[model samples]
Target: MKPLNDVIAACPPSGIRRFFDIAAEMDDVISLGVGEPDFVTPWRIREAGIFALEHGYTTYTSNAGLPELRRLICEDLEKRYGARYAWDTECLITTGVSEGLDLALRVLLNPGDEVIVPEPCYVAYEPCVSFAGGTPVRVATRWEADFAIDPDAVEAAITPRTKAILIGSPANPTGAVQPRAALEGLVRLAERHDLYLISDEIYDRLTYDDTHVCLGAVPGARERTVVLGGFSKAQAMTGWRVGWICAPQAVAELCVRVHQYTMLCAPHVSQIAAVEALKEAEGDVREMVADYDRRRRVFVKGLREIGLECPEPGGAFYAFPSIRASGLDSETFAERLLHEESVAVVPGDVFGPSGEGHIRCSYATALPQLEEALVRIDRFLGSLR
Candidate 1:
C-alpha cells in the first residue's frame, strides 16, 4: 500500500485535544483546556434552527449562503468595525473559521509560498498553512511583550517567497489582542511588500478590557485582507459550524470556486440560525461577554496569587501563565497537573516553541469551576516546590 500524503501525515494533531482525551477518561477532572465558550447557543438562535428544520429547510444553501444572511453579516461588520464589503461577491459563508482559513490559503498560496505567522498563536495556523502548500515562517512573540506581533520582525522575515501574513486577534491560548497601532504597522508592511493579510477575528466580541480593533477596518487594509469570523465564540454556536469570509471580490470569487467543489455550501439550517444570531442575539452576546469579563478578572487574580505569573488577558477567555518557576516544561507541567490535581490545561509548547514555559487555561468555565481549579492548581504547585 502507498503511504499517505506526507504533509497530511506529518501534520501534528491538535495539542489541545490530548489533555481533553485524558480528562474524558477520568472522573472529577477540571478541564480548562478546550478553547470554547461554555455557554449554549442563545434560545432564540436555537429556535431559528428548529423552526427551519420543522419547516423542511434541510437543503443546502447557495454556495455563498443565504442572501439575507450575507447582507446582515456585511451590515454587522460595517456597524461594529467600520469595515465595508459587498454581500453578493465579497462574502462567503463557510463551515467554520477553520474552513475559511483553508479556503483563504488555498486561493492565495502556490507551492513554496511563505506565510508569516506570529508565534504563541492558535494551534491550527501553522499546520493549515503547511497543508495549503505554503511555508509557515514563524516570528517569535515574547511573554515579556504580551505576545503582540512586532511588525518590524514581520517585515524583516519577508523574502521573495513571502506571500501573506496570517494573524488571529483576541487570540486563542494567549488571549492577546493586537492594538490598532500594531495592526496599522502590519497593514503598511503588507502594502509595501504587496502581501495579503489573513485576519482571523472569531473572538471579536469576546474582548474584556479594550475594544477589538478589526484589522480590515484599519486604513488601507480592507482591500488586501481576508476577514474570517463565525458564530462560535461569541454566539456559543461551535457545533453549528457556521462562519464567513469577507474579502475583495477577486479573491472571494476564487474562494467560492474552490468551496463549491469541496464544501458545496454551508448547512441551510445553520445559516438560518446564524442569521437569527446576528439579528436578535446582541443582548445574549452582551450578557455572555459580561460574564466572561468577571471570570477573567477573578481567574487572572487567582493565578497570580497562586504564584504563577499571568499577564492579564485583554480579550478571549484564556490565561497563558508562565510556569517556568515550577521547574517543569509546559508538557510535563500540564500532565502532572492533570494527574495529581485533576486539573487539565493545554501545554503551551504545542502552540509553538515560544510558548515553552507556559500553559493555557481557559476561563470559559463557570466561576465556581474556575475557583476550584485555581485551588487545585495552587496545591499542585506547592507539592512541586
Candidate 2:
C-alpha cells in the first residue's frame, strides 16, 4: 500500500462533527453542536432553483459564475460595507464557503508559508491552511476578552513566513464578532507587512448587537484581502451549496485559473438560487435575523441562570460557555452531558487550546428545543456537583 499525504494523514477530524454523529444515532438527543441555521431556505430562493431547473438552465456557468449573481454580490458588499470590486474580474462563485476557503488558500499559500489564525475559531480554519501547505500559527484569544483577537499578539506572531491573516467573524463556536478598531489594526498590520487578509464573513447578516465590520472595507485592506461569503447561514441556504470570493483582480484571476481546472463552476441551479437570495431575500434574511435574536436572548439568559458563564455572542448563533464550574474539562463535560442528559455540544478545545474550559452550544435551534436543552444542561451540572 502506498502512503497517504502526510499533512492530511496527521490532521484531526472535525471535532464538531464527532458528537453530532453520536447524537444522530440516539433518539431524543438535543443537539446544539452544529452551527447551521434551523430555518429552511427562504421560499423565494428555493423557487428560483426550481424555476431554473424547469427552464433548462442547468448548464455550467463561466468559471467566474453567472455575471448577474457576481454583480449582485459586488453591489451588496458596496451597499453594506463601502467595499468596491469588479463583478467580472474580482468575484468568483464557489461551491460553498468551504470551497472558497480552499480556493483562496490555494491561491495565496506556498509550501511553508504562514497564516495567523485567531483561536476559538471555526473548526476548519487551521486544517484548511494545512491542507493548502501553509503553517497555521494560532494566536490565542481569551474568554476574559470575549475571544476578540488582540492585534499585539498577532503582530508578535508575524514573521517573514507569515503571508496572511485568516479570520472568521460572527465566528463559529464563540460567536465573538471582531471589533472595528481591531479590524483596522489588522489592516494596518497587513499593509505594513504586505500580508493578505482572508476574512470569512459567512454570518455577516446574523449579528445581534454589533455590526459586522467588513475587512475589505477597511481603507487599506481591500487591495490585499480575500473576502469569503455565502448565503448559507443567514439565508438558510446551506444545502444549496453556493458562495463567493471577492478579492483583487490579480488574486481573482489566479483563483479562476485554478477553479476552471478544478471545480469548473458552481452548480448552475445553485448559482441561480443564490442570485435570488441576494436580490429578493433581504426581508427574509431580516426576519430570520430577528428570530435568531429572540432565540439568542432566551438561550443566553438560560445559560446564565444555570450558572454557566458565557460571553455575549454579538453575531453568530453559538454560545461558548465556560463549564469550568463542572470541575470537568470541556471534553468530559460535553461527552458526559450527551450520554447522561441527551444534550449534545462540542468541546471547545477542538477549536483551539484557549477553548479548553468551554463547550460550544448553538442557539440556532428552535426556542422550545433551546429551553429544553438548557433545562437538561442545568440538571446535568447539578448531577456533576
Candidate 3:
C-alpha cells in the first residue's frame, strides 16, 4: 500500500476490545471486560429520542449543540456540581467523552508540548496526547495509597514544555477516586505552572462512597480546567454518542471551532435524549450506581477470599485485583481465565506499565453473572494452587 500517518500506525489495538472479541467466539462466556453500564437507557430518555424522531427533528443542530440541550447541561452542572458554565460561550456538546478528550488535546496542544498523565489510567489518554502532537509524561500512582495522585510526583513531571495535566476521577481500570485534597493540590500545581487541567469526570455519578469534587469548583482553577463528561455510564446511553466539554469562554470558543470541523454538533436526537436523561433519569442513575456498588462489593470480597489482593475502589465500576500472587502475569491470568473458566476480563498492563500485575473486572453486568464469574474465578484459582 502507500502510507499511513505514523501516529495511526503507532497506535496499538484496543486492549479492552481484544478480550471482548475472543469472548464473542466462545460459548457461555461471562464478560466483565468492557467498562460500560449494563442497564438500558431509561424509558423517559428513550421516549424523548423517539418523540424527536416522530416530530422530524433529524436535522443538524448548531455546531456547539442544541441550545436547549446546552442550557440544560449548564443548569445540571450548576445544580449538581455547583459549577457555572455559559451555554453559549462555555460549552460544546460532542460525540462522546472520547471526542471531548480529543478536542481538548487538539485545541490546546502544540507540537512537543507535554501533557502529564497518571499511570494505571484509562487506555485513551496517552495515545490521544500523542495524536494531538503532545508528549505524554506518566506519573505512577501507588496501590498502597489507594492510587491517589501524588502531588510531588506530578510536580516533578512538569517541565517548560508541559501544557496540561489529565485527570480522571473515579478512574477507569483502577476505580480510584481523587480526593478533594488531591484535586486541590493538582489545581494549585496547574496554577503555579500555568498549565491546563483536563478533568475527565465521565464516571462522576458512579461514585459509591464520596462526593465528586469538580476541579472547576476550586478557586482560580475554573479558568484553566476543561471538564469532560457524558451520558454513557450514568444514564446507560453509551451507544447514543452524547458528551460535552465545559471550559472558560476563550478556550471553549476554540473548542467549538475544532468541533465544527471535526464533527459538527452531537446528533440532534441524541441531544434531546441526553437532555431528558439529565432531567428525568436521576432515579435510574441512582439505581444503577447502587447496583454496581453491590456487585463491586460481591466481586471484591470473593476475590479476597480466593487470596487475590484487590484495593477497595471508592468509585467507578471496576475492581482491579492483583493476580501476581496467583503466580501469573496479568495477561496470562486473564487468558487462562477466559479459556479455562469461561470468564473474560481486561489485563491490567493494557492500562499502562504500572498495571502489569493486575486485571480489571467490571461490575457493570447483572448480579447472577457476577456470582457465576466469581465461582468460576474461585475454581480457577484453586486449580492454580
Candidate 4:
C-alpha cells in the first residue's frame, strides 16, 4: 500500500515521549522525563474555565483570539518583559507554544532556507524546521559554557541560505538561560544578517536567580524577533492548550492567517482561563517557581555529591548532567536507570547529537518524589562503579 508522506515518515517518535510511555506501564516508576509543571492550575483559573463553559461560552473565538485576552497578553508582556506589542496587530493566540513554533517556521521559512538551532535544545525545533522544508543547522552549546549560545559559532554556521536563528532561553532539558550579553550579541548578528530571530521564552517566569530577559527588549530587536510564550509553564496550565506569539505586525498578520487554517484559534474556554491566569494567577506562579527553585538546589547538589557533573541551571526545572563518567552511553544509562531503579529520565541525545553521554532530569515533581528519585539515581551510579 502507498504510505505516509515522506517528511512524516522521516520524523522519528519523540525521544522524550517514548520513555514516558514505557514508564507509564511500570509499577512504582518515578518519572522525571516529562517537562511539565507539577503544580495544579490555580483554582481561580480553573474556575474561570468552568464558568465560561457553564455560561455557554464554548463557541470558537475569532481566529486571532479573544481581544481582551490579547490585550492582557500585551499588558503582561510589557509589564513583565519590557516589551510592547500592539494587541490587535501583533498577537495571535496559538494552541500552545508548540503551534506558535510551527506557525513561525511555516510563515518565515521557504524551501532550502536554513535555520540555526543550538544543540541540546528543546527536541521540537529541528523536526519543526525539517517539516517546514528548511534545513536545521545545529550548533552545539557546551556544558563548559553552561550551554550558552556562542555568537562566534552561530555566525560561523550561517550561510547565504540562513534565514533565522531559533533560541530557547531558560532552555528545556538544560535549563540554561541566555545571559544578557549573549542575547545582545545574537541580536546584533540578526541585524547584520537581516535574519529572523525566533525566541521561545516559554520558561521565562521559571528563572531562579536573574530576571527573565526578553529578546524583544533589546534595541531594534522588537522588529525582528518573534517572541513565543504561553500559560503551560508559568501558570500550570499545560493541558489548557493556550499560548501566543508576539511578532512584528506584518509577521503576526501572516501567522494569524496560517493559524486560521491550522488551528482556528486556541480553545475558547482556555482563552478565558488564560486571561484570568494572566491577571489572577501571579501568586500561583510565584509560589511554584519558589518551590522549583528549592528543588533545583537540592537536585543539583545531590547529583554533584554522586560525582555527576551538573551545572547549576538558571531557569526551568531540569538538570542536564553528564553521565559519561559512569562509562555508559546516554541511552544505555537511561534504560538501566528505569529498569533497575524505576527512575525514568530522558537521554540527552534526544535533544541533539551534542547531548550524548548526558541525561535530562526534570525537578518539576514534588520534593518527596525528587528526593526519592535522587536516591535511586545515586544507587544506580554507585552500582556502575
CA lDDT of every candidate: 0.94, 0.92, 0.92, 0.93
Per-residue alpha-carbon lDDT of candidate 2 for residues 195-292, written as tens digits (9 for 90 to 100) = 99999999988898658998999999989999999989999999889999999999999999989999999999999999999889999999999999
Q: Write candidate 4's Cα lDDT for 1-385 as tens digits.
A: 9887888799999999988899999999999989988888999999999999999999999999999999999998899788999999999899999999999999999999999999899999999999998999999999999999999999999999999999999999899999998999999999999999999999999998866799998887999999999999989999999999999999999999999997988999999999898888888888999999999999999999989999899999999999989999999999999999999999999999989989999999988998899899999988988
Put the candidates in lDDT order, highest first: 1, 4, 2, 3
lDDT of 3 by residue, 262-311 (tens): 79889999999998987788998888888889998988998898888999
Per-model tally of clashing residue pairs: 0, 0, 0, 0
| TM match of model 1 to true structure | 0.99
Error of 3 at 316 (Å): 1.3
Taking all chains together, the TM-score of candidate 4 against the true structure is 0.98
| Poorest stretch of ten by lDDT in candidate 1 | 207-216
Model 2 stretches astray by more than 4 angstroms: none
Using all chains and alpha carbons, the TM-scores for the candidates as numbered come to: 0.99, 0.99, 0.98, 0.98
Model 3 scores what on Cα lDDT? 0.92
